[model samples]
Target: MNPYSVRTLWISDLHLGNKDCKAGFLLDFLNKHDAETIILVGDIVDFYSMKSSHHWPESHSQVLSLLMQRAHNGTRLIYIPGNHDAVIRQYLKFNFGHVEVRASHIHETLTGKKIIAVHGDEFDSAVCHKRLTAIAGDVGYDLLLFLNRWWSRARQRMGFPYWSLASYIKSKVASANVAIQRFENAAIQYARRKGAHAIVCGHIHHPDMKVLGDELYLNDGDWIENCTALLEQHDGTIQLIRWTERCELLAESYAFASLQPDAVSEKKDEAA
Candidate 1:
């Protein structure tokens, strides 16, 4: 069975040392997909949470090992440290074999659009206006994620498909929605300042992609609650795929193989 081959794969908010990290799902995704380049947008390690409640299982370790092995095997890996693991910022420009650590990276899609890869905390800090306030907000966000886990489990037992309780709550809350909007706006502004046509980031754990005026915004989401990844096809099309929802439909190794260009466009041409 062929694998889902992609030109670039972006993933972030792994929070490897945290209990909520979905290492198993990430492993499954990595096993099923092949990418020429992998961008670890940020929070790959939850050093912040580790200080308070350490929880690193074998699965998490396996994920790290596999990524390093893949790097050694010639896959290009770029890591951008986020606030949670900002200690790596000191190592910016360093290379551990095929892996490169940088403050940020500008990725040029096959279609020639330049997109900056970042952790998105800069936008958060700018929008939140204060470090203390951002920390307080994080505490509340964690509570929502805790509740989201239990709610998801209960729903699955009752035969419901996967859903994000945290996302639902965020959408319902006025403040949360405002913060998200501000964050996205800030991201676009930053991209414009950097001369990029698009931005790919992950911090809010909200997987989304949209064209905002002349700019494109893409978030790879998180491994914890959403289990989503952003993919760039060989033809330069971007896809935001939530693995949890499609795992059943993609049990076959050849599922989504090649992720080719638009079939709808081909159909239209044929019709004409």
Candidate 2:
């Protein structure tokens, strides 16, 4: 399959430096797509995990290298650091390599619609105000990811395709679903306040595209779990693309060899 050329691409929750990061899948996605603008929505690096134990693998390095290469090749790179990598917030509005680092950005689409791009953590009640609760939630999420890794590994051994155990569990949990809804509503409100036609953000790791009345709310999802991204087409339409599913399709067609390894073993040691 030919690489998809898009107007803009937004991805986040990479959690690089964390063991659970799906760097290989991200690299594969980057290789298969070219965009005029690429937005690193948030949590590009898991500095929280790195502070305790550094787990920067070769794949993570490759992901960074590929992103820099894309910027050098003239793609506009915008990074909005999230809670996990909040240290970068100190250098807001600065340029690292060819990428622009900002707390938030306003993107004007091809259709002349203004969309606010942010990490969205600022709108999350637990993340913004309840520090203790946020920490506890983080711990719980890490445990979920650990179990998800083991489950996915077992599925692979049984010749089953990749599945997101964490994502499925999140859907089943009432509280988690409510949190997602609140987050989306908060994003929509923020967009309205900003006078934007829509908002694109990542932090909750839930990939969704929805129309709330006359406004739109878009979440790029996360690389660590769902392996999804939000892409803006040339005509300004936005859609979520699941990288794992795309890789699986490519593997089935025997079109790309790079995604083959990931399609078989996407699980990583828990430390997310």
Candidate 3:
């Protein structure tokens, strides 16, 4: 639980203005772990609705304070805005209170591989050009969140741990899976177009790390579902890590296994 043991951390989809942000769990994760750099992938705040109703809670403030402390202590912080907070796009190239915000960025890993870091909303057909579709998706998403919240509450009362109903359905529903697959393909293709060897994104709320052809695709699942993050080790070895239920490092596809060992070794060397 020592915060000082980690190197780099990337997380997304906190939805701070939403009541379902899970700030407590996030605070626990932040307090328990330390990283040299922290990447806030996007949608850290639910800006879409913040204009209509102000809903920043105490826990939300606490999380912000935690990040501020880390940044003050020299942790490099990078933020890429998501669709929900698209307003930040205007200030993407600026710094906000110790956190650097960007629309998207290409990050070079320690192993010299280039990775495209973005929120992935641009790839979703329903999200990109159509406001109506986006609103519909939001409506559906809100219903799911409502169900998930009470469902988890009931589960807890029954001695079961919290679980994401939306995520469970996302993994099983054919249409949802297909959409996610398409999004993944688009992201990977975009990475290729951008001359990147890997792509790390959020906004779909699904946590996954997969390899397709010569590229790697990673999604830092949202707190609403997988409660996960994608981490880039010092040597450029990427990992999909979860934060709930004791914190787990999930298995990731080794599409480019040849590139991994060297990265891990380099990380060790850097640490040493």
Error of 2 at 51 (Å): 1.6
Q: Each model's RMSD to truth, in Å?
A: 6.2, 8.3, 4.6
Best by lDDT: 1
**57: Cα error in model 1, Å:** 0.7
What lDDT is obtained when candidate 1 is compared to the true structure?
0.78
| Tens digits of per-residue lDDT for model 2, 86-134 | 9999999899889999989998887677889999878767334343233
Candidate 3 root-mean-square deviation in Å: 4.6
Candidate 1 lDDT for residue 60 = 92
Order the candidates by lDDT, highest first. 1, 2, 3
Clash pairs, candidate 2, are: none
Q: What lDDT is reached at residue 253 by model 1?
A: 16
Segments of candidate 3 deviating more than 4 angstroms = 126-136, 253-272
Q: In model 3, where is the ten-residue run with the lowest total lDDT?
A: 263-272
Q: Return the candidate ranking by TM-score, descending.
A: 3, 1, 2
Comparing 1 and 2 on lDDT, the stronger one = 1
lDDT per residue for candidate 3 within 1-272, as digits (tens), equals 34535656889988888777888778877887678888888898888768878889899999888888888888989989998888888896898778889888777666677778898887866334343233224676678777888988898799886677867755666666667777788898899989998888888887888778888888888876667777666555677766654556665423233544222211111211
